[model samples]
Target: MTTSRTVPSVSVTYARNGGSTKSNELGMRVMQERAYEKRGEQYLLIKSPPASGKSRALMFIALDKLANQGLKQAIIVVPEKSIGSSFADEPLSKFGFWTDWTVTPKWNLCNAPGEEGGKVNAVETFLNSDDKVLVCTHATFRFAVDKFGVEAFDNRLIAVDEFHHVSANPNNKLGQHLGEFIARDKVHVVAMTGSYFRGDAEAVLAPHDESRFDTVTYTYYEQLNGYEYLKTLDIGYFFYSGSYADDILSVLDADEKTIVHIPNVNSRESTKDKHREVEHIIDALGEWQGTDPTTGFQLVKTPEGRILKIADLVDDEASKRDKVSAALKDPAQKNNRDHVDIIVALGMAKEGFDWIWCEHALTVGYRASLTEIIQIIGRATRDAKGKTRARFTNLIAEPDASEEAVTEAVNDTLKAIAASLLMEQVLAPRFNFTPKTPQSGPVDGFDYGEGGYDPEKSNVGFNEESGQFQIEIKGLAEPKSKEADRICREDLNEVIAAFVQDKQALERGLFDGEHAGGETLPEELTQVRMGKIVKDKFPELDDEDQEAVRQHAVAALNLTQKAKEIAVTGPDVEKGNTALIDGVRRYAMDVRELDIDLIDRINPFGEAYAILAKTMSEESLKQVAAIISGKRVNLTPDEARELARRAVRFKQERGRLPSVTSPDPWEKRMAEGIAFLARMKAEAENA
Candidate 1:
C-alpha cells in the first residue's frame, strides 16, 4: 500500500519561555499570580511544585507589590546562590529604584573590609540605608541580627525559599537570631514551598517564641495560577512510577508514550562475564535509534532504571565507575529527557535540571533524605495548564514508610522556601529577601552569561545590569527581524527561517547557547578576549557558521554517499569487509553525482556529507521497537529505525529474498477478510 508523506506546516506557533496570552504582554501565572491577586492578606504562604515556575511567580508578585504606591522595600531569602538573580535579570523588571535595595551576604548596602563585620555590616547597611531593602541569606536571619544587633532589622518584610531549612536546624545560633528578629512583627510575610508544607509553622517562623501568621498554599491538583509552567511535562507521570505503561499505549493509540523499559547495564569491557546479560541489554539501546526535531542528534531511548547491587552493579570503585558510565549512556538513565519517561536514581537528578513537557515524578530510593527527595520529586512537578495549574505529584511510598512521617518530612524541609516567600510578602516584595551585597575588590565568582547562568566556562563573575541585550546575549541568539506579526502566517515562517539563521550565527560565536530543559546556557569557548557589542550590529556575511550557510559550492561533485554498514551476507559470501568498503565508496560516488537541481531533496539516509561526520555513526539499535496500530512515523525512533532497515533490505534485494510473511500471503489474508466483511456489509446495507 502506498503511504502518505510528511506534510510540512508553513506557519508555527513558537513556544514562549515566559508564558503570555497576547503573545507579547508577559504576565504572572499560577501560584504567584494567585498570591498577587490576594494582596490584602498580611501573610501569603505558597506551597507550589518546584520548577512549576514558583520562583518566577513569586518574583513577579513581589515586584508588583513593591511597586505599589505606599510600599518602601522588601526582603527575600533563598538557599541556592544561583537563585539570587531570577528577578535581577528579568527584562520586565519594575524595580528600577530597588535594584540597589536588596541585601545579601555577597551583596549588601555597606562594604566590609577583609570580611570583618560581614554579617553585622550587611544588617547595619540595610537598616541605615534610605532605600528599602530585601535581606537574604547564605547565613540565617538570626546570624544577620547577631552580627548587627536585633535593633537593626525590626519590622522588615521577610521571604524564605526552601523555607523548611529554618526549622531544619533551629538550635543553631543564627536560627535563634532570625527567630528573634521576626518575633517583633507578623506583617507582610510570604513562605513558598514546591512541596506540601506541614509541621509547626510557628516554631519555624517565630522560633524565638510561638508566633504564626495565617498560611496560604496552592498545590498542583487544585489550581492553575501556576500551572502553565508544567504543561510540557504532563505526560511525565506514566514511565516514572512504572505504572500503566500498557494502559497509556492503549488509550493514546496514535500518540503513544514509548516506554523503553530500560534496565541498567555495565558498559565496561573489563567487567567479568557475570553482568554481561544486562550489559548487552544496555549497549543495545545506546545506539542511534532516531534523529530528533533538532536534526543533529540521533534520538535514542535512554535506559533509566535502578540496577540492583551485586559483585557488579556497585562492587568495586573501578567497576562501579565503569558500570555507572555504561548505564548512564541512556539519556533517560542520565535523569535527562530525549527518552520518553523514566524513574531513576536520585544520585543522577540533581538541581538546575528540567525536561521539556515532563512533569511527573516517582521516587523509589529509600536512602535519600527528605530534602533530596523534595528536589527529586519537584524536578518534574512543574505548574500545569488551565486553572492555576500544578502537577499531580505522587509519592510511591515503600510499605515501611508512614503517611504521617512522609508528610512531616515534606513539611520540615520545604518550610524554608515557604518562609522566605512569606517573609517577602510581609517585608520586602520584590527580591526583598536580603539582597546580595556588591563585591568590592576585583569581583571573582562564576561568570554566568546574561540572566544569572553560571556560564559553562568561568573564571570571572559578570553582571549584565549595565550592558545592552545585544551585548548581554554575546553568545546567545537574537531575532533578526524583531518580528511580531501574526503567530501563524507565511510571514511568521519567513521570520522563523531568519530565526534559524540567527541561531547559526550564535553557534559560530565563542559563547554558544545549548538547549537545556527549561533554559539555555552558553558553552564557553575561551576567555582571552571578551566579546564586546556586535560592533557590526548586522555583522557582515559571517562565514564562521559556514556549514549553516546555504551555498552552491557542493553542486559540481561527481560522487554520491549514503549510510553504509557491515552487511551480513548469506554464509556463502565471505567478503564482508571488502563489500562494506566498496559499498561505502560507491555510495560516496553516487552522492557526488547526484543532480544539483533540487535543493529540498534530503538523501533518505541523510546529507551526503553526513556519512563522514562524527555524529552520523549507526549500528543495530540498542532497543528496537515497532509500531502496532499506526504508521511508522507514528511509531517511536526505535520503531522507525526498524522500518528503515526493512526498507533498506527491500532496496538491496535484486534476487530471491526470505519470505517469512510474504506480501502475497498477507494480501490473500486481507482479501479473505474483506470478502467476509463485504458479505456482511451487503446484507446490512440491503436490509
Candidate 2:
C-alpha cells in the first residue's frame, strides 16, 4: 500500500503572562501563558506535543515557584541521558523571563559516572544543599528515593519531564514513589510530557490522583499552526516487496536533509547490517569520497555529480561517534542543510535530538507504536529559518506467504491509517459553534421552525475569521436559540446515551439480540429498531416531540452507516485499487485528504439529540430555552423524575450527596436530577 496526504497546519496567536507578547516559538508562548495562568495551583500537568515547548514552559513555572512562591527548591527529572540536555543551562532572563535557569555542574547527574550507589550519593548531596534547582535522570531519582526515603523530598517541587514514563502499575518504580509523594502531600509536582497517552494502554495515573491535577493541554494542531516558519508536514507510507535497503532511495531524496532509520535488529526484516544499509544508500546516492578530516562528514558524489555529506549515527566506533557528533553539533553546521545531506540512524535520534534543518524523516519498516511515530515526526517539525514544510515517509515491506501474518499486517496498517486520520483532527483547528438564525430555506442541515436537521446537509466550512473550519448547524426552531439547543431539541445525545449506557439495549437495538417478545432483531441498528428504542426511552414525551426526535435518530444512524460505507468500503469495492498480498486486500487511502465537507454534512448531535430531545419535549424545550436565555424554570414532577434518577445513582455510588456547587458537568447534572426528584417527592407527600 502506498499513499500520501498533506498535514494541515493552522496558525495561532497567544498572550503570555496575561499580556500580549509575540515570540518566535508560538508553542512556547502559548504554554507559558497557560502555565502562568495556573501558577497559583500546586500541581500542574502540561500535556503537549513534541517540540511544543513543554521543557521551556516547565522552566518558566519552576523558576517562578522557587523564587516568588514559598516553594523551597525544585528538581527536574528526565527519562534518558539524551533528554537531560533539554533542561541544560538556559539564559531565560534574556528571553524576557524573570530569572535565569541554571543547573550547577556538580548537581547535574546526567553525565555523572556511577553505579546506583553513586547516583544515590549524588542525589543526597543535591538534596542536602540549599540549591534552588537540580537536574537528574529518572534512574537517579528512583534510587535516591529508595536510598534516602521520600522524606528527603519534603517541601520540594518535583518537576518530572516525559511524565508518561510513570505508569499506574504499582510495580513501576517511578510511579510508586510518585504515589508516596502525593500521599504525603508535602511535595508539589509539575508533570510535563510531549506524549501523555500510554501506548501500552496502561493508565498514566490512578483516576483519583489524575482528578486532583490542574491540566493544561496544548495540542499538535495549536503548535504546528502557530509555527513561525513550518507550514506543512506530509506523513505517508510506501510499500515494497524487496529489501528496503535496496529500495529506500526510491522514496527518499539524497539531496534533502534526511534521517534514515534502519529496521530493528531483532525484527525479521533487519539485515543485522547497519553498515550494509548505509553502503546501499551511499551507493544509490553516488560514488563515496574519503571522509573529511576537518569535519567527519562523509562526502558522496551523486549521479548528477553533486557532493553530499552523510552522518553515520549507527556506527559503534567511539572515534567515529565523537568526530560525527562534533561535526553535527558545530555552530557552523547549524541550519546548513548541505553539510548533512543524510543521517543514518539505527536506534538514536527519535526524541530530544535536535536538528533544526532536517526536512525529511524517512524510516524503514513499521513502527507499532503511535507515540513513537509522533516522536519521530517531531524531528522534522522544529521551526527552521528558511524551511516552510517537512515530510515523513515510512517504507514498509509487504507481508508474504502466511495468511495469519497477512491478516496481522493488514490490521496493523489499517489501525495506523485510522490513527493518522484521528491525529489530523487532533492537530487541526477546532470548530467554533454559534447559534444559526432561522432561515427561510434550508441552511447547513437544519430547517428552522420545522425542527428538521438533515444529516446530508452537514459539512466542514473554512472561516476567514478563525482561519479554521466552522461546523455550521443550521436552523433556529422550537425554543432555545443556540447550537446546543438544536442538538438537545433533536434528542441526538439521548438515543446514544441510552444505547451506550445499556449494553443489552445496545445489542438488541443495533446488534441483533433477543427481544422480550422472542423477536430476533437485525445485526445492525435498522430504522425500525431505532424508532422503538427512541419511543421506549421517552415515555413521558408527547407524540409530536417524540416523532421529531425519532426521525433525527434514524437519520443519524443512517448517516453513520453511509459514512462507514463511503469512507471505509466504497473506495475498495468501487475502485478496486487495493493490493492483494497473501490473499488479503490492503487498502491504501490518503486520510489527510478526507472530505471534511462530506463528514461535516452528517450531524454528530443527531442521534444524541434524538435521545435527549425525547424527554425534553415542548414544555421541557421551554425550560431549556429559559436556561439558555438565563431565565430559571421552576421544577415540575416529570423534570423532577429525570433529576432524581441521576442523583440517586450518584449518591449510591459515592456514599454522599453530590454537591450542587460542583463545577464538574456530571456532578452538576446529578445535582439537578436529584433536586427535581426531591421536589416531586415533596409534592407526593403533600398529596
Q: List the lowest-lDDT window of 10 residues for candidate 1.
A: 426-435
lDDT of 2: 0.59
Score every model by TM-score. Answer: 0.36, 0.65
Query: Model 1: number of clashes?
Result: 98
List the lowest-lDDT window of 10 residues for candidate 2: 579-588
Candidate whose lDDT is highest: 2
Tens digits of per-residue lDDT for model 1, 1-687: 111111110001112233321121244444455565666555565655555556665555565556662444566666654345443434442532232223343443122234434554565566666655453453645556566576554445566666655552466564565555555553356666654322232224431232233344443323322133432222111111122221222222111211121122321111233234323433344443542332122233444532222112222346454444344344443343333333233234334344433333332212223344345545544432331211222221111122334333222212222222221111100100011122212233322323343222211122222110111111212222211111111011111122212312222120111211111111111100011111121133242212111211111111111212212222312442123223322332334322222211222112211211221112101010011111112123332333333333334653443243545432222233334444657899999
lDDT of 2 by residue, 1-687 (tens): 122222221111221122112353322376567776787678788877777677888888887788888888898999887677788888877766667889887777887777768878877877778888888888889989988899889988999988878887988999999888888888899998776344454556664565567778665655665666676666656555557777776787876789888888865456887788788888888899989887777789988988888888778897997789778777676767666778888778887778988988888767765567667888887777677777887765554434345534433433344334333334443333332333322334321222344234432333222223333334311323232233333225335434333323332332122221222223123323343455575544554445445444433333333332343334443222110110011110222222222222333323322322232233433333232233223344544454454466457768987788897634664576577666667899999
lDDT for every model? 0.32, 0.59
lDDT of 2 at 198: 49
RMSD of each: 26.2, 15.8
